[model samples]
Target: MNFPRSIRWKLQLWYGGLLLLLLAGFGFTAYQLESARQLRHIDEELQQRLPMLVDSQRPIPGDRDRRQFRLSTRDALLFDQTGNESFYYVVWLKHGEPVTRSTTAPEDVPQPKAGDPPNRLRGDVRESFLFPGPGDCVLVGRSIAPDLAGLRQFAWWLCAVGVTVFAAGLAGGGWLIIKALRPIQTISAAAQSIATGDLSQRIQTQDTESELGQLATVLNTTFARLEASFSRQSRFTADAAHELRTPLAVILLQSQNGLAADHLTEEQREAFLATQRAAQRMRRLIESLLTLARLDSGELSDNRAPCELNRVAEETVRLLQPLAAEHGASLTTELAPAHCVGNADELAQVVTNLVGNALVHNRSGVSVHVKVLIEDQHAVLTVRDTGQGIAPADISHLFERFYRVEKARTTAGGHTGLGLAITQAIVTAHGGMIVAESRVGEGTVMTVRLPLALRGADST
Candidate 1:
């Protein structure tokens, strides 16, 4: 049989088994008592009758030689030895005769064989009798078979009472088990509902030291951490956007002034170029900050359409090739044909930032490799760089907005420190994840993961 899942069901099974064991024990006890009682009663009856037959052997003074058979209306008889009858009244002897006879016994009453005397009634009911003296004359006997219908009826009633008590106990145990587990059921429901976006939900705790109470405390702590993180991210986004406005406004005004000048000389042209470059940097910074803000805010794109991820990787490589070449780096790609559900533009940006970060940080001889493949039901995009790898501590903070591994490199290469952050943000918006792997001497590898098919499901 299949087992039960709930605590109450388990309790029922255990209680029922115990009840069965108890019932069996009681039945064994009852059978033993009944057998012993029957044996003792038959033994007492035989002892009482043996002496009465001997005393009544002689003739009564008034009634003459007829023996007084005190058989109590039970069949009684008397016999002499040598298989010869002395007197027969209400009882008779047949082929295998009783040593003694009972007057009330049937004529065909089954008798013990010559050497095989009947024992006390400890087995199935059968007719029998015996005596200890010579010939049939010394043996006298009677039959006594009391009706046991009343005893049988009482026994059935006792069994019924036992069964009723057992059933009640089983039911009571089931109720107790349910009561004990109600708190766990409550906790499970609360957890499920809260995951459906009820941040206000808090577990009910009755005892602080109990296991359930401890679990509730832990959940409350986790919620507090999530709330604090969200608040910090929101503030950072506002401050970052405010900081980018000034540089962007200055660049626009300078560009307008240069365009309005009467005669543009080579020196003026060079100054204008620098101003434009600064303007472009400010614009990129604002875009990166916005992207990070969207990511932290959980404003994800729902546009999940089939796209060749490898094609997107190749295009990003082509676009960033000139930038890598300027930094004396070689950009290479091994684009595998892989399909996924995500925003194509977002995937492109993820590849672009990894390549850009590699080229900008390396002093000389940088090599970038981009590959697209499927791994464990996920679309894997890896971008590896042959350069001075990022430090172990700095790799984790690489995706944080405006975090730089080396400040000197940031200044020399004009890095705003928002490239990796923007890349991570874009990947997240498409319901994917990104991580950087690096050691002290070995080069860094940044990996991006996207679901093979969106299927209207969250990221793995």
Candidate 2:
């Protein structure tokens, strides 16, 4: 039927069908009851009239006169002992023969047909009764037509009122259903607006304790997160372009200068080697940028298995121990067993960056400390170094790509300045966190925390 899409129409259809069924049931019950009552009333009326007829037409036992009995009756019929037609239906019989006669009845008065009641007939609005006589009983009947018309009228009015009430109830119920669903409709529209790139759009809350209100609150929180992510991506793109251009320009200039030179001295060759080192640093910086891009795009790893944090720390310290010796510093580890879900190579990269950052920055016999411990349902790995700690002002931006506090460190080792930034991205991709703690002259401590795997998970 192409029914309405609105909740109002749906509710009406549901309750309206029920109302119709209830009304039909009531009508059926009423019809049966009224029909039974009418039939009973007709039967009682016939019973009352039958007795009066019996008294009015009573005849003497031996009279045998059909006219005498027939004229005395007003609206009745009589039969003799042997079955026959009669009037007012009164009949008389001769002594020992089959005989029948009527003296005072209408010609059209029905006579007993073969296999029919001898003196009674039933009709739509009347019932007839028969009484036995030695020609001494009669049949009496009364019309019940008047009550039928009244009952039909009452039924028509009842049906009309029932239908009207049902329609009213359907309308009232539909209104209530639409009112209840209105908030859902509003929330849907608001969601559509948000999907169309309107990040600032928010659903209005009416009832804080209701489910819809909670849904609106959740949507608002999700929008806030999406906005922050968008802002970070935009900033990353701008910052990466600016940082990469400087090193590329320097490398290009160094190549051009070397190609134009002739009869170069040993010092000139050494300078050229330094230029190559700068180009290598630029290459590394570009690679780190690619890694961060992959991490942010969620394309990093397909397999994550439980890894021993203690083993990762030992390996990271071993790789950087040479650099520490070069700098007249010691690399050390205070490893403890802890398990996490991660890509091993990526976790190794995070540990290497932290300890490398410490060794490069500290020249005063620095000691690198690595530790594994359980904290707040997570496996924690820490790298602390005895180095010239970061100023409070520079701590916040230390992990930003190409953000350096000292230009002298950048020149000496051609530091790409993306080390800690790469570390942060790796840790984040593994569903972990990295944070730095430093004081101006004491040292720097970097902590990475990862979710710990349960017992069975570690079996893999």
Candidate 3:
């Protein structure tokens, strides 16, 4: 059977099961004790009335007076209060023969047999008692129905109370478990925030000796180390990219100059052109790395002035139209006035990167569509392309640095593979998010959402 996997529910099940077992055990024990006590009380009542029954008989002097003696004895015993109809039964036996029985005595009650025990067999609901008398034996019995009924009622009451108590305990225990685990819930929230790039978030620990507290302490230490390591790596990459930029620019310039020289041989000219392309690729790669580093270090200042996203989308489409045409692809734009607070150049770069990716990856005859619109107080930019869609396994890592779907495809275009990564970082810096949706053989859609700027003419 599939059971609840939550700790709180498991605890409640265990607690309720143990409680039910305890209640059942205690209830059974109490019922048995009460039943035995009631039966004993019945036996005692029968014994106490035995003497009165025997004393009512007188010794007979002759056989002729025996009938008279029998009649008087029967009359005396029959009129006794102990022999009431609903309470007790009385029988007098002589020489193994029943002489007189009370009016209330049942006919099924057997005659006292010779050498029978004082309290012999009657039945479950009735108890029998035999007392030796002067030349005779007396038998007394009482119905134990009232006692059995009382025990039954008590058992029912116990069950009701036990069930009520169990329900209360289960509810109260669930509440207590939630309260007790509140710290863990807080820790989980902090961890999620950290995972989402807020490395400054830490769990607030109050009891270092406890398990959750200790776990929080360990996680905080690990996060601190991770943040520091990332900071160092980002700084190194930014410094290296900055240092190589000037040298790469010089190398490209020198190679172009050599190719332009009138004295250069054909083979030498080709070699210089290759060097120029390599240096240009290197420069682009370095610039992309620098941009990522800046985004990671939070060095880019936020531009709170309203920028028209529709205008940026229109301009990017116009600039990339030639490339789309060269690939035999149709480029179209549906630009609506949507304004967001971000750098105009950076937002333009985002549009350029998305449209550029669509034009580059798609085959001839594919159509690329760009749209800018206002959606739920956000500037929504959507770029959709009717091209070969991304593989399921490669979609998730598309924004990772230097990640590409296939090395051959990237090599053919001389792609550095940092375009989407840089694009994502820029969007994130603008307090926006980007989502990519694609299915194999269906095409791809990239959606960017930026918070709308609500101030000044931007609100229009």
Runs in model 1 lying further than 4 Å from the true structure: 1-247, 263-279, 407-410, 454-460
Top candidate, metric lDDT: 3
Going through the candidates in order, what is the number of backbone clashes in each?
A: 22, 6, 0
Over 4 Å off, model 2: 1-264, 267-271, 407-411
**Per-candidate TM-score against the hidden true structure:** 0.50, 0.46, 0.82
Compare candidates 2 and 3 on lDDT and give the better one. 3
Give the winner by TM-score: 3
Go through the candidates in order and give the C-alpha RMSD of each one to the true structure. Answer: 11.5, 18.6, 4.4
| Per-residue accuracy of model 2 over 92-135 as CA lDDT, tens digit each | 23232223233433334443323444324444324344534543
119 Cα displacement, candidate 1 (Å)? 38
lDDT tens string, model 1, 43-62?
Answer: 55544555545544444468
Give the alpha carbon lDDT tens digit for every residue of 1-460 in model 3. 2358876678778878987898889888988888788777777776776766666666566763242124355545534544223444555545555667666666777666557667754554454555555346667776655666678899999889888988888788789878888888889899888876767788898898998889989999998998999999999999999999888888988998898789888899889989988898898889888888988887764554677999888887899999998889999989899888888888888998899888887777889999999999999999999888988888889889898888213345677889999899889878889999997777899999999887575531
If ranked by lDDT, best first, what sequence of candidates would result?
3, 2, 1
